[model samples]
Target: MPNPQLGATSLLTLLIFPDVKPDNILVDWELDEQGNQTVKEVALGDFDLSLKLIDNQPLRAPHAVGNVMWRSPEGQSGKGVAKPSDVFSFGLVCIYGLGGGDMLILDAATIKNLKDHGMPAEQEIVVRHFLYFGPLSQGLLNHVADETWHTLFTSAGSIAEEEAIDDPDARFERWPKDIAPHITPEAKDLIIKMTHLDPAERATIDEVLEHPWWSVGVHNG
Candidate 1:
């Protein structure tokens, strides 16, 4: 049920889903009579973790959800979840789908290995972000309630140059290259915009919808 506290809703009304991985989202296609498919709609499910801000209050607290692979960097930190968390997760889902079911560093086997390492799985995922996206901002790092994470990054929120090692995976950097098929630059740019390491820097849901990638027309890929 929709929260009564939300009262009337408009295009600008904001709601946060603490978990927005692909598992919680569904897409439907408008099929033609000739047995062809056309994507027409997307539905968000599993509102058990859905969140709503009341009276302009900020959302803060531990999250309850699964699927560490798709969770946002900020959510993994102690900053609590926000709308950008959903954007980050959704951006990953888009990457997964667009890349033809492969995002090298984010594969299940890697996440399982991290889970088995007896540390927070997000720690390694954060490392991948640092390597690929440059660095986490101090403003973003300040939200981390855990002091241990401080040792892994520099004062500028970047991995130390001497200790840094690139993943060399078939991800954003390899898009439209030999590792990836003919994915468009517009597509790559949109995902980067949505998945900025700093939650505050992530594109809003509206901005993502308005991205030029959507204008390129859908391809089966």
Candidate 2:
């Protein structure tokens, strides 16, 4: 028997693309002799808003960068972005990919309407986020620190739903019809973990890539 040698260990570099959407992801597909399509390689691009953190701490920016419709709570807050920010954005990208672009935490049309009506879409988006990922925890709301959210939600982590705005036409209509039953448990777990409302609670991007969903072959179950 031959002995196996240990190679150099890969170091963890906390990098944040801050913006991860379907448009930024590049995938190269290959077809085998049997005409089976396989993923040759996958790459991330549009690093104009990308950042590499020296430590695991959040990277604060002057203004809100990244795609508006696909930004993480922290990133959009104009405060800072961390590994969990990337996890949340990429998690949404995964949802969009799996659902064939059907899942959107905040749709552009809704945002446009809110802006047109002199309403901060952040409030509505918060409402949609609560519907999609569950209510915003006190820790998350405190971190984001949006004025409207702080006013609408109490320090006890309860939101005043009566005062919140909503998109009557598309308030999570796709959740039950396009998600839930269609997504695998492993995938759902990973995505939910990645998209945890609290950055402190969400898994790091490293943990996301190393999740069992990628290794267990339980995606169909």
Candidate 3:
């Protein structure tokens, strides 16, 4: 299915959306022995499945901030969940759902190598972020708080000579054109903004809802 159709359908079906990850969103379909088929959305618990309302503030799962979830650097560094974080994960889902699997910049072997060399799984995931979505801006780099920043930057620099296409803009320009042919330019633009490395720089859900891709007659009713 085209991502816009899937995204729009999801939004319409789930009145309150949270933790927008692929695993949380399911496709319900079945085929009978007589060849009849049925498909529908199945509700899984409450709208806030992975969230907890504490003192009226929501606390989301920390483990969700990784390869599949697409949290910003600050988020991974413990800034906690916000709407922008959800936007980042939603963009990841949209890109991967719309035939953009090959756009994932890291392969399993690289991840394994990092782990074998003593990088923690969480830090390894962050390193992959830098590899895929960096050379970080000076402002973003300065904002990075922990030792993970130094580790990620040093690892990125070490690979720079071997990785010719290190610029995020360069990679972004080539990504949808090559891997996700089904994605429109406007959709790509939305995804790029939504998945920005800085949470402050990422698009809000309201902005995403207003993006042209959602209203361009490309999605299903």
lDDT of 3: 0.56
Lowest lDDT block of 10, candidate 1: 1-10
Q: Candidate 3: worst 10 consecutive residues by lDDT?
A: 51-60
Q: Write the per-residue lDDT of candidate 1 for residues 1-221, one digit (tens) a residue.
A: 12211221242256777676777766666667898876655677777766577764545555523356776766655354677777788777777666634542456667687678875556666665555555556655665544554555443244422234444342355444554454567777887888787777889877877776776624413
Off by over 4 Å in 2: 1-12, 33-35, 54-56, 105-111, 120-122, 145-149, 152-174, 180-182, 217-221
Q: Give the runs in model 1 whose Cα sits over 4 Å from its true position.
A: 1-12, 33-35, 55-57, 62-66, 104-112, 115-119, 143-176, 217-221
Expressed as tens digits, the lDDT of each residue in 26-70 for candidate 2 is 777788899977665666777786667766567766666577667
1 versus 3: better lDDT goes to: 1
lDDT of 3 at 53: 35
Model 3 TM-score on a 0 to 1 scale:
0.63
* Native RMSD of candidate 2 (Å): 6.0
Task: Tell me each candidate's RMSD, in Å, in order.
Answer: 5.5, 6.0, 6.0
Candidates ranked, most accurate by lDDT first:
2, 1, 3
**Clashes (N, CA, C under 3 Å) per candidate:** 0, 0, 0
TM-score: which is higher, 2 or 3? 2
The reply for model 3, stretches above 4 Å from the true place, is 1-19, 27-49, 52-69, 105-110, 120-124, 138-170, 217-221
